[model samples]
Target chain A: MSNKKIGCGCLGCSIPLLTFIILLVIILPLSIFGVMNGAFGSKGIPAPKVELPAEVIFHIGVFPVTNTIITSWITVALLILMALLVTRKPKLIPGRLQSAVEAIIEWMYNFCKDVAGEVKGRKFFPVVTTIFLFVLINALLNLVPGYGTWPITNYAGHEVILLRGANTDINTAAALAVIAFIFIEFWGFKFNGLGYLKKFFTVERAFKGWGKVFHGKLSGFGDVLFGAIDTIVGLLELLLEFVRLLSFTFRLFGNMTGGEILILILFFLLGFAGFGFVQVGYIFEMLVGVVQALIFAGLTLVFATMASEHHGEEEH
Target chain B: MNIFDKLAELGFSWPTLVAQIVNFIVLLVMLYFFAYKPVMKMLDQRAQKIKDSLDETQKIKDQAAVAEQDFKKRLEVASKEGQEVIARAMRSGEEARQRAQQEAKVEAQAVVEKARQEIQHERDEAIGELRQEFADLTIVAAEKVITKSLNKNDHQKLIEQVLAESTTLNKKA
Candidate 1:
């Protein structure tokens, strides 16, 4: 057989480029003018205002249950029902739903195993997977038409959005971050015992080493200075733990809330023209939602694994 | 204004946070039991079953291969035994035929020797009787020829001469 290079030539690339140019030059401008003239007529599109706070849907005892919380509750319920459907009568030979669920779980398990080693990965799997599912499902709820558009009650004489993404609520994001932080600390204590405290308060080691100088183990001025610096760094590391909590909260809250706000703004500008733009934004938001979920779950598992390990050991 | 007030303006209610925490905890617990645990268990069981089936198939194939080899070996042994039996029978048959031929030859030779001996004895007896009659006839002929009563010595000499002549004739025949 003769050796031949099999690849698309310049013609293949030019065809798509030519098609794109034609659309951009003709169809795109025409469509924009048509939407502006036909849809808006004389009335121009209005300026949009983004609402940052979640709307209160109801009051439960002393707590004001927001629309985001309601959406989360529904999401959780649907997720639970899906879980029951898949696992109700599990067979060795799986059905479509069961197989899809199994594939997701297997993927998560493998991902966790890569982030955390096998033993700790199994321990962290459920929490990490739950966080991913909750975030992803809650994020997807934002894309539904009636989610934020449906009016519930009058807020300051204007109708308010009834449903919102759960993670867009600062309280929910903070809660999730706090839960993850608690689990990280718990694992640190469980694995390292009293040594876990030394990661934050390592100044005691300097004093201990000072005594060790008499025994000729750490018998240098440089060693003492280095130990002091190490102690200060350990304190900084302790501060960073709080930073991690803040980052986890704000990152999720900002991304989800920003996407919602961007969609609203897009809908306000150019009226009908913005509809196609919002569809594109929705797709981007969906991707961002999935990415955020993976990042959150992956980071939590990594932090948990790191907390459980000795600081001095090289990771395997 | 306090930082707490500023945060509260951002929809940060302590009660709502607590409720959200409760909600997350509930979600986590429910998801763990209903989704993660069961799904992982089913996957593990399915994996185990697949492994077991593969192992079982491998074991059966190996057993079949072993049985095939055993059958082949038995066939070889049976064919070898059959060949050996035929070879032994042929050898024994050849030996039996040779032994029977040698016995027949010996028996015939013994019978022929016995019959020849008997024939020789009977011929010798007949020859003796003929000799004796010839002698008596010769003596009577001599007496008649010599009517004048010749001597007994002459008659005896005549018989002996006739007997010698008969022996010579028999030798010539």
Candidate 2:
């Protein structure tokens, strides 16, 4: 009953606050003035830029390994290490790290149970929770000092930035959305079997009770027209499903990338004067990160639950 | 260039998407097996342990309550029995007192009767001696008055008549 979440002991909670203040208030202005006055000589201030595409860090055969992918790998490694550390010794009475980890998973599990019914909730719980953590971690990783600031020479002899937010990359977001979409579809098939397709194609519903319409005579026209339109609407809805993929991808990619660009521009233009603005932006970006993660997971859970249910299984 | 061309220029490679998917799947599988499963299992076990201990405590409490009730019931019975025993002893004591009182009264009556009988016998003896003394006195007096001897049959008849006259005189007095 008294279980509390204690932060990882390695870094104090104030470290992040201290880091932001030092970077934005002190180092930024100092670098700006020093560079403008030619204190470092030759080169002027290296203005922060947001590269749209993640640069390839290295190659394995013909395949290009990008910096965002590397960041993702780092995220995965850190998460796995954290997992191992917390779970190394499991106890009935959980310690700080274990309690913190359990609290988060418990919250996500409860959220899933609330949105999806208990049975289907557990079925999609793993993927939904995973997506949430991955997105949230990737989003927050952008706040790190050296993240997306590292520069390296590619095999093409051009300077390419190394290490960016994984979710900021459109490809990564697209892949995540695709996976969620696929799972939603899979759950739809699993629960409703062939009946799941009826939501997408209304051709069968169009023909249903056609005999009654004919027997009623002359009134058959209304039913035919209604059915046709209904089928057409179903087709449009089917098309919209693909649109969902694009929206999911862009929503995550735009927010993260836009935040990155905004931070860069604000830091470059205002320097010290923009400290308050940048802080506000940073807080906003953090909220957005959590919100977007929640939305993505929530949407996936809704879709999975919807897919698993029959058309008239329950009232709205 | 249009939007599609711009997107193509952004390195929207299928290979990269596939790679990212593969990376994610690997992460999912790893986390599910190593992290989520073990942690969830431990949490469930802890919950179950707590529930079982709570149940055991409740059972013990109920048993204790039952024992307390039994003890109270026995105490009440014992107290009732003690009161009954005391009442019985009191009743027996009352009976014994009555029996002893009746026996003492009877013994006193018997002693009084024996004392009365002894007094009567002593009185009877004293009365008989007195009567004999009176008869002897009368004879001596008669002998002094007459100064002569009488014949045998005449003497007996005269003594009898005198004795009868003396008895009648004693009764009248």
Candidate 3:
């Protein structure tokens, strides 16, 4: 036979071909059948239990320490460790780790600058970058092999997973949302001073129209009607501002929890098949992590930009 | 049930929220100091370094171009000066040659003039001698023709007078 034929008449070619046949024709089917028949000391896959509240593992002075809190602390430590490693002795000509770190920070900085103007973007960059790194790392680390599998006994002597994604916890999401809200309002007040309140509590036009009516100008009723509409609109704007806190919190919490549940369910449903197929969900989760991080940071930047601007002034 | 009860059901605890907030704030501060500030400073430093190097290169290039032009200018001046020196040498050679020819001509003319003056002097001396001999022969012939007719002194006086007259006539002719 020619060397160009299927078999190269050498040990190297035959070994790989034989391995492929055994894997695809024999082992793959056998594994699938074994899993289906509950063979090889295998109990059938259990139904995935979806938990909403992060389980409390311990208490510190009446404070419950949940798995999500532990995970967030790990995320914080990991981030700080990376920062220290890359920045310990920064070189003018960067090495790989330094370059990667710089790329991430610079990209986020530029994103903030693009969404907000230079001065405001500079002010907002730290908070935005922090949120992004914290949320993204938590999401990605949740997909590591030991995350949902490492069982520990809580103080109540009940078994629970040691680590969970922080973003899946509503409290962490709310905390982030609360911080974003505070900064947005703070920037608004800082840039526009007390005039920032005029966007929500517009009473000057109504007072002026009433003064005109006292002077007996009948057409002032038009101004009154318009001012009333403006006031309602301003109230709506105010209500939406508060509503942003809820939306931001739920959006992150829901997406992270849903993605985790999705991977868990897919593994349970596919069993032997999931070894290869569940990687799709992992890739999708990674993409979702990145996108969610961007959305969270980008929205905060946009809102901060909007807050810092004067309401009635034309945007440059 | 109230909204507060619903929020509790969703696991919204004040302590966890506070802890997370504090955690985020700490991270923001740490990252700002460690990562953002140093990296930005490095980037700016790199940019400044590149710009300075580029400016230095341009300066060096300009200096090289000026040096080359100066070299070319010096070469041209040297070549022109060389040609001037050669032309001066050739002009001085021609002048020397002409001066030597003029001096030779004047010397040859002087020699020729001196020879002519010497030849004139010799010719005058020979002519005087020949006249003397002729006068001597004519006197002897007259004495023979009138041997006893007159005394010797008288013949000598007469011959002298004749010779004087003939000399005057020859001078006139």
What does candidate 3's lDDT look like per residue over B34-128, in tens digits? Answer: 87788878877988999999999999999999999999999999999999999999999999999999999999999999999999899888778
Per-prediction TM-score, chain B alone: 0.59, 0.61, 0.54
Question: Across residues A58-168, which tens digit of lDDT does each residue of candidate 2 receive?
Answer: 889989898888888888887777788878787778889899988888788889989887888778888998899888888888788788777788888889778888888
Candidate 3 lDDT over A164-214, as tens digits, reads: 889889999999999999999999999989888888887667777888999
lDDT of model 2 at position A275:
47
DockQ, candidate 1, vs. native dimer: 0.50
Off by over 4 Å in 1: A1-30, A34-47, A154-158, A209-220, A274-276, A312-316, B81-173
- Chain A vs native chain A, TM-score per candidate: 0.83, 0.83, 0.90
lDDT of 3 at A298: 87
- Models 1 onward score TM values of 0.73, 0.74, 0.78
| Regions of candidate 2 where Cα sits further than 4 Å from its true position | A1-45, A205-216, A273-276, A312-316, B1-4, B46-58, B92-173
Binned by DockQ into CAPRI classes (incorrect, acceptable, medium, high), candidate 3 is medium
lDDT of 1 by residue, A33-119 (tens): 756674354145345556667777667676677887888888888888898898788877888888898888889999988888888
Q: Where is the poorest 10-residue window by lDDT in model 1 chain B?
A: B141-150
Better of 1 and 3 by lDDT: 3
